[model samples]
Target: IMVLLVLIFHLLFSCSHSLQYFYTAVTRGINFPELTAVGMIDGEKFLYYDGNTRQAIPKVDWIKNNVKPDYWTSQTQIIRGSEDRYKASLVTAMQRFNQSGGYYHPFQWMYGCELDGETGATDGYSQFGYDGADFLYLELRSTSYVAPVQQALITKQEWDVAEAERRKHYLTKECIYWLKKYVYYGKSILDRKVPPQVSLLQRDPSSPVVCHATGFYPDNVKISWQKDGQELHEDVDVGETLPNHDGTFQKRAELKVTPDVWKKNQFTCVVEHKSGDPIHMILTEEKIRTNSAGIIVGLVVAALVLIAVVVGVVMVVKR
Candidate 1:
């Protein structure tokens, strides 16, 4: 789940800048919020509101430190209004789908805008989903809402061009304004780059070699394996980037090879991050953690420490 979230985060922030809002409404559920809203800037969640909380709160320190209290109050009121509307919409959607009884169904709305910081170009998107399927989406080029499912055709017909125009205006203009403002507010943290700590790990001599890189900021990283200075795409499994507890990112790529192949040829795990030059960790028996040799070394050290403690106790007794 953490990896999934981090992957989404990485994709969201792939562009130069972005501001997104997500609203979810559930028809019925146990221990689940009926309505919830989240606001994200540059892929990082900054504001969150739920039915239980009934208040819009900042999720990040930067937002709390930069945004005014009244802003939160205003956002709370806005989300409260949205909650009522979304709840009603959920019912309407269920009715359209001819669904009844106490079944859990979710209606989601997402709208966002992206800005290319380098080229000054922008893009906008608005989409709605029901029961984990695409229900409707705004066609920015045509300035109209498109219904993907039969049940949503009614909504598409009802949503007038004026509404679509208003959405477009908000997505293209207002959303970009807020995105830029948020970027400025969180520039220090958003723009900063931190290098990753790379290591070679193995469960045992026969296990795959894992190139683990963690504690990297910005979430953009590349990890690959090379055999004899040539990239090896086969027998390599690259895991998804996962979020660290401290907002950094981590990723790992495993290389499956026989001990003979690795020992005979030069195999290297290369990690590329925006923070600095690429890190290359050559595969060697000594560099791999949890290998047979490493375990033996650990046991020897522990036994020596125990013997030293026992000898010291004997000398103290003699004294």
Candidate 2:
């Protein structure tokens, strides 16, 4: 009974974590600035909304009870009044940056808010460019924690003045307060005790040999292909550990080699799982294809002929 209970618990935990990742993937989706672009004729920009709930798609909620056209109208009125000026500015910026080539490419501009359900850990940030490489960024972790632009675009004294002003009006405002409520929230599911099912196989005569390891929990594991007790550095392609269909995960590594190299040296695939010692599987063409199909068929035919002769002799003796 205890063993069965443990098995039941294990299954429920894996399913829960898989569901959580699925929900996050479908509703919020993974953010890729280059792909989810909102193309503008004169300029380039994109928008992201975390929404009141966690979801893959952004929601549109402007019901009568929540309608605020007057405020929005006023804000747009200012931009409408100077549409031509703004348009010219956008064109000029694009030309100066040389949209054809990336002289001063603004890779992405994103404004997002996240909501967490379980931990109640709320935070929001607006980051632009590649890891602070001439980029602008700001993050609000909580009331006491706020970060300024990551890159040193301005003097410290100038940044200090700007940051102080921003905290009062921008960071402390209700708009930001509401966004802080969503930070990919949930009761974190922990799956720490599952091992991977690994296999070693070689493709056609001249193709690359591959090691496929999959059906495991906790996406961290190592796979290596070694030859003559030496690890292969070149001609090897290792893939990232990816999630599997059943909420488990998988990864593959391949070694590119010709048949001559493969036949001469013994290559082995070694996998390291978190739960147990490393698994060692070898790759050799002879072991994989021990006999030809024709050879087996010939052996069967010879056995049938001998049995027929024995039956003929037995019939004669009985007569």
Candidate 3:
């Protein structure tokens, strides 16, 4: 009874955490139209209320949330990316700033300094202008938490002034810092891989053959295939891998192509490694044929022998 109770408690706790994760994912933009709450451990599990189903999913560990906190850190440098893709709240914040007479330019280099500075005026670049590159809306994001996730605000300008010693760096850093503090909880990072491997297999004719390419790193790795050296335009299918549980994900990409393409041409599956030379998978086919005419003649002779044997048995029985 005790053991069973312990097992039940473990499950309850796990389910609760799962629900929390599920809730955070859905609420934070990992939309799952088919989401439902199935398990729980911490009545503390975070969940986004689903009005349709009145339930939630156990948020997976990687479902990131972008909350803003009021702190700072070194890895929290403010950098800018295209803002056209920002969340509505961020877009609205920027619009409000522009409406309020703040300069809303792309890649605005704001001054940063230590939170505690001796200079009455903080020392740093006030602003820089972009000339050639189309300025995507500016975003201040941090990879110190979730490498792929970013937090943006059109109005972080309020925190742009250098107030402290290293205020230049700090000022430059505030938006990212605040984003991390507000949005991310420090957790185990995904084990990043450098160079992943590539292999090509399963070549045939008649139907589209599935190209199996494997061994990728940096969870965000992309796989693309080409025919006779041209990139594949058709949609390729991706498959899930057995999780390593250590953070690195194993995955596969499959591309289907007509046998005619594979017949005389070189098929390549390229694994775009995050840091090293791209791994390439190459497939070539050799012509193979079977002689049907010889087989047909042999079959005919065998049938004739069988008929003669049958006739002989009948004659022996009649005699």
Candidate 2 segments exceeding 4 Å error:
1-189, 286-319
lDDT of 3 by residue, 256-318 (tens): 656665666776767775557777767554321222324323533553443222111111110
lDDT of 1 by residue, 173-238 (tens): 999888877887887788788999887877777888888887888777999999888999998999
RMSD of each: 15.2, 21.6, 24.5
Q: Order of all candidates by TM-score, from best down to worst? A: 1, 2, 3
Task: Give each model's whole-structure lDDT.
Answer: 0.78, 0.42, 0.34
Per residue, candidate 2 scores C-alpha lDDT tens digits across 94-177 of: 444444432322233333333233333334443333221323345344323222333334323454455544643443354334
- Per-residue lDDT value at 317 in model 3: 12
Candidates ranked, most accurate by lDDT first: 1, 2, 3
- Tell me which residue pairs clash in candidate 1: none
Model 2, poorest ten-residue lDDT window?
A: 18-27
Preferred candidate (TM-score higher): 2 or 3:
2
